[model samples]
Target: MDDFRLFTSIRYDPELLKVPSLGFTNVGWNSKSSPFHMLDFHRDRMLRAAIYWDWTAAIASISGQEGLENLERFLQGATKDLVNGPHRLMITLARDGSLGYEISSLPATHLNNLYPEYLPNQSFDSDSNISVTVRGGKVPIKDPMYDIFVDSQRTTKSEFTHYKTTFRDMYNDARNRAKVNPGDKKEVLLLNEDGYIMEGSISTPYFWRNGKWVTPPVPRKFDAFQGSGGNDGTTRRWALERHLAAEETVLADSLVDGEECWISNGLRGFICGKVKLH
Candidate 1:
């Protein structure tokens, strides 16, 4: 299956998850170049994971500016035919540094509309120079508000959990233990043995505490039994850089029922979510 390949799901969109601090101009539909969200961060993350796993070939494949450009070109060519999209780009890397990808159309989520503060100025020319035939299909429906739950089981933190790769058995197991249905608009949060919240099955988890947003802290290094951390997600990194959220140890038992909070990932930005403790 595709899960055997090391991968990352990137949101290739004309608009979505765009912030002014990223220092990009003519983003979204106005982009004359490839419109990949947080491309640098994603590249760096994969490199770091490859280094950790000692995947030398993978490291060399995505090492620097040249690598970034190569990746951008690949994405552009892959989506050149799409007339309109906010598609999810599933990029996979093999041990030999060979690349594989799959593109799927995505519906507009409430991300940009609900979090306008994170959006870039949209006063650019309306006549976008990008020319691609729009695929014929019914307009995709907006994603529903997600139902977030805390898993009863504790997960052991390791390199797999720290990196965004295809080895997602830990996450998949957590979801299964919680009996999460495939079509359910739900995310199950994982906790470590120390009782600190790690992250969600497929997204980073955040909480509102003391009037501030706090996510679980991820340690730089951890021994087999010592490090109980979460993935350093792209959205999580962006939030930390902008001070939109802070890193603090969040105990799993501290979460309250029906509390409002947020969750984020590369494909989906900060999503308005509600806690459902069981």
Candidate 2:
């Protein structure tokens, strides 16, 4: 089968300046079943996510003085070509005032790597096949660090936590480390400066404690703890709105205290696993 394909506005055009824009929407096959809840919140979510990329020029150009209208027009056109599938669609605005978008699909095998059984509104549940490891080494500037004060106060001056920029070297490192020494893992959970469980490098980490599903609290600049960091993902929102999950502070060593563990992202939705700290 095809390794999935991409339909991006930048593919054909070579002179685009590549200005950063925030917005991505992914849907499962059949176009109607969006397992990650994209159907209900993708548009709004994209707008909210755009806050992370709110550059001065981008904001000034699109803010007051009829600029917002033009920006909306660009957003509508950029996201218009998206359709349902096991795919990811992203729209980015160029610094040179160009719109770029990409729609990418994944094959069944790639899908199986994250979820053994492909189904909408379903999570990966495997025996020993799925494993997780806490991130080690120094935290990068782009990645979030835990702040106990941030958790208590609920401040919102978060910079990198809410955007999906391409700064993923730290996450990539954790994933690579998990693959070492026999290799029985697929996800890398992270911890904050104070050594508390924060989130997955690329996904939201959750645990099954007592009789309820709980996830790490969202991090703010001076709130208290390091959050799952990223926009409010559709899966996380779905779990919360449906009462499938709750938010609470979690410690790194406390990971073993849970009866079950899981990580979620737009692409994987939710992938259940067992923790193996490193």
Candidate 3:
């Protein structure tokens, strides 16, 4: 596996930083949600970002150097390092939809085990917190589809959602659980809420047949049910054009038959290494 070299930054759980000795909270999320859902709460216009799903990154360098710091300082240092081109930030959200102050180090897998945990989170408490050994290995983004993917979405979202929204309590619990079960296991397959074959630990769901990048219909779990803005959309507005494949089809009814199933997401952007699912 190759390390996806992108500009990187770090954020932290301010609470953890206040107590500097304990390990820091390392996380991130795809925070984008409709603000109108809380129209009543915003009469004063006091607002914060609300995301659908939030996850963790990692905490380490390949050389065993712990780079734990408050996010403001981390971002400043990352900018100073000058390697920060396209960056990923590690963060934690509090229960109230606020951010924590412990940004993680590089090599995201250390945060939540990119492979398994990111898809299906785990559960842990003060009793659990296994000592993480095995210093490091940074796997560069394997799919060239990512850098292009994250940026390709120039389409306007119907509503406003600030996912990767503020760090919250649910987010904190999930992050802690990931420690007990690091998702780096290569063989693990990511499933949806129903346990159906959905996607990989990071990749989105897509299948190739006749040389096309066709993905499953965006599931209803994340759909916006009210007026206007909803989850009915694409990771990339021009998903078909960017992948250089043609003929878009939706598997919302069912998975694409016999085509090549590849997972597409921020981490493992696109993966075609599928063996068999049924």
Candidate 4:
């Protein structure tokens, strides 16, 4: 059962990450109506992976209106015990449609402060119907940065590299190989056998190239012998949707030492950082 469950982690905050195209906002912690970063995008990504893996029951658990309602209910119940603050909400679904979640507090990020042009304004319509009882608080103001490292070894691309799941042995092994010291604020970027930079172990990599933010292209078709591309991360999707970043093939050799770049995940939005190539 553990091996069959699909999962995703998302940012749950009282402050909304607005989505004007949706015409309605998603419920967030403590807000009567708001957004959960890129909730729909995350759901769609998981749904696609489920379809690819032929997990019919898992697909049904996260697919349409019913699934959305069920997810809201689960989140509402799970967040009842939470305190007023932003959180990292990790949700998992079983093959039998059972849902589980874990909530952890997160320090505020400088996403809006660092990239104001890319972030949407915090606006919500009073007519929004979605509501939840989760607690809310101010977004943290402490800006944290990370040190990025290029892995010395190349990883073979596979379904695990392209999808977000519990099957994380490859990623774990990559991190282990890096031998990072405890409490190190760093991420190890993995490369493919063909020398294409894939992604960070737990975040999406965005390089500043030709006067624009460019991320490694994620290939739709998986070729065992070719690069599997990187995971289609929600943060990357958000950046691409807003034209804040472009998708291009990034070669490991192209990375410049101490060059400014960015990395992101569902928990943290766009983060400014620098690269360290081996």
TM-score of each: 0.79, 0.54, 0.34, 0.80
Descending-lDDT candidate ranking: 1, 4, 2, 3
For all candidates in order, the CA lDDT equals 0.69, 0.42, 0.28, 0.67
Query: What lDDT score goes with residue 143 in model 3?
Result: 24
Candidate 2 per-residue C-alpha lDDT over 118-142 given as tens digits, one digit per residue, 9 for 90 to 100: 1111133222333322132111121
Model 4 poorest 10 in a row by lDDT = 121-130
Indicate which candidate wins on lDDT: 1
Worst 10 residues of 3 by lDDT: 35-44
lDDT tens per residue, model 1, 1-278: 33355678888876543434433332332223335777777777777777777788988888888887777787788779877869889988777787788998876654342222331111211222211112321111123557888888898888778877778888898999888876577889999878888898888877777667788887654344544478878777776765667888888778888776578888876665678885
Give the alpha carbon lDDT tens digit for every residue of 1-278 in model 3.
12111111132222212222323222112111210111111111111222222212221111112322233343455345434222334333333433323332333222222211111101211122333331332111222111111111122222221122232233233324333134332222233333233222233445444434554333223343321121222232224423423334432234422323444333323233333323
- Clashing residue pairs in candidate 1 (N, C-alpha, C atoms within 3 angstroms): 14-28
How far does residue 123 in candidate 2 sit from its true spot (Å)?
16
TM-score of 3: 0.34
Report how far residue 84 has shifted in candidate 1, in Å: 1.9
**Better candidate number, 1 or 3, judged by TM-score:** 1
